[model samples]
Target: MEAPPVIAVVGPTGSGKSDLAVSLALELDGEVINADSMQFYRGMDIGTAKITEAERRGVPHHLLDILDVTEEASVSDFQQQARALIADIHGRGKRAILAGGSGLYVRAALDVLEFPGTDPQIRRRLEAELEAAGPAPLRQRLEAVDPVSAGRLGDARRIIRALEVFELTGRTFSSFMPAREYYQPAVQIGLDVDRELLRERLARRVHAMVDRGLLEEARRLDAAGLRKGRTAPRALGYAQFLKVLDGTASVAEAAEETVVATRQFARRQLTWFRADPRVSWLDWQDPGLVARATGLCRTVPVQPLA
Candidate 1:
């Protein structure tokens, strides 16, 4: 018998991918495997807009809260762990639902991507460069060597890691990127929304996160060494509010920055998912979204999802 099809719900943040994933899981008798990198860290609840237990509605969620604030979440590690989790879920005769708007993490979990090995010495040297000279110079160096990788790497940690990959392997980091190929038999459902409406929604979502104690959560994580986390520190709300905790910005200012940053992040995510022609697009606000997504999943011969 053929393996069960892996289901992926992907879109920009605030596009309701999480809720859709839950609906898909319920209809398909599936389990959710989180692809959001920020949600990987514990104590990052409010800032990450992590779903509460009640919101989960009894579905088992894997790969969430598996890392402390101090640990860097590695895409390579997630790829290995998530594939194993998906295999286990498949072995149990259940479908695996990959959920999150995090483009790279989602791709890492479901794509035929390869992670280049890291050399400790080279990583240390590149990280030292990032610390002493900051991201500007390192990014400039990455641009000189690998413009494609440099363009995709927005954070200091990723920039440093890409540089390290170049130095250690003598190959451009982009060379390792997977061809538009799936790691398994999978169907990806993408949510579509008006850009202006999405911007409005993202702004409102940031304000709601603040109202829900994102600031207080950031403060707690600060005491718990959030700044030490290379990946977590670069997350949307956490980075903005860390400025608030550092006395560099007011709570309102931080929240506003988070809104703007999140909107830009959403645009990037949409671009990433849209580039793949295989994804079936659905109007996010459709009245029968759940029904439509379910039908797409159950369709045989895998008709293109629109």
Candidate 2:
């Protein structure tokens, strides 16, 4: 028998992707591999809306809570880990369901993507330049050589990495972007939602998280050196609540800020997934969402293992 195609449940945050993925896993005899970058950190449950053990419904989950809050989240590392899990699941004659909203990480695992090699020396020099001069000068330099990357990237770290790639490979970073072609036979099911409803839902969810002790969680993680981390400290709720930890903001203010940031993040996620024509979008609130997603998974084109 041919192997089952990998199933990816994708969409904006709080769009029911996780629940749908869990249902699909149960229906399709699959295990889930997380693609949500924020969920990878230990003790980040409430802020990240991580699925609880009871919510997992006996389905196996991979790659959650695998990183310390102090470590950087690496897309390349996830690419390797997720691919290996998919292969192992396939070898056991089970389906591999990739679930989450991290667009680049999802693409890194499923698409025909290559991670460019990095040079530490080149990166250090760029970082030094970034420290001496702000990102404006480096941004201008990147714009001259790779305008696409410059326009797409907002943060100094990503900008520095793009410049490092250019210096190391003499090629534009955008040139390495993956085409939509799948690395393996796969199907992506995107959960679509009403924007206004989702925005409200996000706000409510943020408030619920705060009620569930997001501020306390943030305090615990902050004591664990969350502020020292490059990535974890910047996650939506955690970042805002850290202000609460230092007395710079009230819990109410942090909760409001987290809601705004999460809503904005969801918008970006929607924009990212919507750009991929390969994804089969389903109404997030559809009563039969699992059935529809399962049907889509069943029809995935057959291809040999990579």
Candidate 3:
């Protein structure tokens, strides 16, 4: 019997990951399984760049809009859901295309990572430290305690998590973290675009979001009390727009800030994906990118054990 195949399309935000995934799904008869952290929320469409039904081009998407914005979703949760979805897709003799820019989420779904079970006391202390000392001090402390894990996780939230694990287990977080062994047979395709072009695209996308009632969406989410320090709330536009809602920033200023923050995020995402040896990179502007990606997908030998 042949083993199942999975395709993963990963890149920085505004790197055309969605479009590529959609096109590939249409071409390959695949369903998109979202790997973005924020796009999992039901009410976070505009800010998370979630694909609407209309935008799916008749291709099915899974693990999107499944959680309320206020609900806390973890990497383990995502991995479990994604693995189930992939199995279902394979059982149906269809393709599963994993797509998004969230590096940790994508990594969790692809690599067999054993997340330490949660500890409320550790979490409470870490949250208190984050509240009182801000992310920098917590990040510095994580770096001091677990430089390897800290270096792997440059994002503030991820750094905090490393510290939380260390605090609870009294061991380096890296010691508990799993290696990057493939969990399934997958064709990992990374989208790469010019930095300047990507920045311009991000700015344009943010402006488009503003025109698409992003402020109203943000207001509704805020009213739901979902704009707190939750992971979803910290997504690119929501946090910046919250400043506008609280009168700390003008709408125009918030929009600009969102663009800047998203650009930085895209940079970080590129760095993360670039560092991964598993992904086969492709130039986003290549006229034959789709053909190349599809060809690579077809040629990847399926691993029975995976």
Candidate 4:
């Protein structure tokens, strides 16, 4: 029998991607592989909205809580791990459901994306420069050599990475960008959301997170070295709540800030996934959303892998 095509449920945070992934997994005899970078860390449950054990309804989930709060989540490493899990699931005659909203990580798992090589020495030097002089100098330098990447990249870490790639390969980072080609037989289902409703939903969700002890979780992880983590510390709710711990922000203030940041992040997520023409979008709130998504999975023909 032919293996089932991988089904990826994707969208902005709070769009109900996780719930739909579980429903599809149950209906299709599939297991889920999380692609959300923030969900990689252990002890980040409340803020990340990680699906609880009971919520999973006995369907197996992979790649959740696989890293300590202090460990960095690497896209290349995730590419290897997610791909291996997909192959293993298929070999066992089960479908592979890739689920999450992390755009680059999703592309890494299913798209023909090539990650640039990194030199630690060069990276460290660049990081040091970033720390000493801030992003202004680094952004200026990147704009000089790789204006496309410079214009696109806004974070310090990515800017440093682009510079490192340039130094190592003597090629602009943009030159290494992959076309929207899938690495395997797969289907991407995006949850289409109403921007206004999602904004309100995100605000309520952030408040609910706070009521559910997001501050306590953040404090626990902070003591567990979340502050030392390169990526984990920057997560929306945790970052805002961490400020509450430091006496710089109140619980209400943190919750409000988190809501704003989350809404902004969701907009960016929509932009990223919408740019990829291959994704089939479905209304997140439709009564037959699961049925529609499952039909998409069954009907889409998977091309032969090259």
Candidate 5:
């Protein structure tokens, strides 16, 4: 009669969290709720490394392929949807496994975090500033207002959002860091790999994606309005390949850039997850990882709904 605890599998992009989530799901009688923002788009499979049906191993996955390339993904919207799905999954007496490398999305799903509302006019104005002046000045403004978020945010889109949050809420975005409390009973399992080894693996993975027609995929999506997509077009592999199609880079150049970018992104993912003391880390290559994670899940204290 007790409610089940939520288990989150989080880590760097290439750390095999999805496979491990499937293993844990099989062991714990759970379904996966994707926390990867990029994987939400239907046609972004190859670039996002979305799991194939065969790879899902019969464990139901949620929140994936639910968006089109044209529609922007909002973490606030996702937070609402994911919490409801977790409640539904729990109501059905199955544990919910939150899986993905996107740190904010993972936190939004399980942590006691609240999203601030956005103002369209303010957003348009900031975006205009970004277009007129580029990201450096906006980043400088963010550094003046919200240095912590400015330090962490590397892209123009996110930098603009942070500034917008400060302007709209009159509070710095980083000041809203979620307390260690969970919205529901939850546990986080983090996966890790050695830096040099992970770099090699990521490079190989990018090459493999190119071999699997990443260029072709990007081209198809491009003709389908990828350029107009505020978010989807800026995703990792998609952005690089867009350069290839633009004649600004070669396919090989794009692949190499993707490898480098993904490696840096993996490091950022590690830093973000490692900051939270609640996450228990395991080596991705551990042979007994599933059993270990199963034990951890069983022992984690279940907090009543908050």
Candidate 6:
């Protein structure tokens, strides 16, 4: 049997990944499976830049708005769900279009990384250390134990989680990284855009999110106890708005901060995807982006099923 073709549309935020995915899906009889981290939350529409019903253009989308604001969604969780969704879509004779800006989630799904189960004792000790000494001490500990993993994971929460896994399982989290060869037959299409244009679009998108009641969404998450420092709450807009809500920053200050953070995040995403040789980078702003992507899709070499 031939393996189903999977096309992944990936890039930094504000790079028009979703638009490309929607266009490709419409033209190719594809169903989109979201690979974004925050787009999973049920009520995080505006901040996540989630595709509206009209934007979907009747193309089926999976994995968006599937989780609650209070819940934490892991890369492993996404991998399982996305694989299942893609298989189902293929079974129905449709292509699977994986799309989003979350590099880790995308890597996990495509590479089929083996994530270790959580250990409560290790988690408790880490929690206690965080309570007593804050993230710096735990970060220092992780740096000492696993410098490579420490260097790769800049986010404090991710670093600590890696440390927790190491402390509990007595193995490096990096050791569990799946080989690149594990991915099923796939084509990775990365959206590229001008930096200035992306930044301007990000600023405008942030304001549009505010106009669409992002503040109200933040308030709702705050009411659900998803304040600063929590994993689920540390997502871009929510974390910045929480600072505003707590009076540590003005609304204007929060908006500025959010834009800066999101731009930095976009840069990080670009770095991540660039490191992968498999991705075929495309100019997202190109007038013929759809045609180019469609051409690539049609020409992708098929592979034998496992």
Write model 1 residue lDDT over 111-151, tens digit each, in one string: 88888887889988887887787889998999999999888
- The TM-score obtained by model 5 is 0.94
Q: How close is every model to the real structure, measured as TM-score? A: 0.93, 0.97, 0.91, 0.97, 0.94, 0.93
Estimate the TM-score for candidate 2: 0.97
Q: Model 6 compared with the native: what TM-score?
A: 0.93
In candidate 1, stretches whose alpha carbon ends up further than 4 angstroms from where it belongs are 133-140, 151-155, 300-306
Deviation in angstroms for 263 in model 6?
0.8
- Deviation in Å, model 3, residue 114 alpha carbon: 1.3
Pairs of residues clashing in candidate 3: none
* Candidate 6 residue spans exceeding 4 A from truth: 304-306
Measured on C-alpha atoms, candidate 5 has an lDDT of 0.90
Model 4: per-residue Cα lDDT over 232-266, one tens digit each: 99998999988899999999999999988999999
lDDT against the true structure, per candidate, is 0.87, 0.92, 0.85, 0.91, 0.90, 0.83
lDDT per residue (tens digit) for residues 134-153 in model 6: 88887788888888788878
Cα misplacement distance, residue 224 of candidate 5 (Å): 1.3
Clashing pairs in 4: none
Clash counts for all predictions:
0, 0, 0, 0, 0, 0
Query: lDDT (0-100) at residue 306 of candidate 5?
Result: 35
Instruction: Give the per-residue lDDT of model 3 (tens digit) for 154-259.
Output: 7666777788788777888898656678877787899878889888899999999999988899999988878653777887888888888889998899999999
Local distance difference test, candidate 2: 0.92
- What overall lDDT, based on C-alpha atoms, would model 6 receive against the true structure? 0.83
lDDT of 2 by residue, 163-192 (tens): 999999999999999568888889999998
Q: Give the worst 10-residue stretch by lDDT in candidate 1.
A: 297-306
Error of 4 at 125 (Å): 0.8
lDDT of 1 at 193: 90
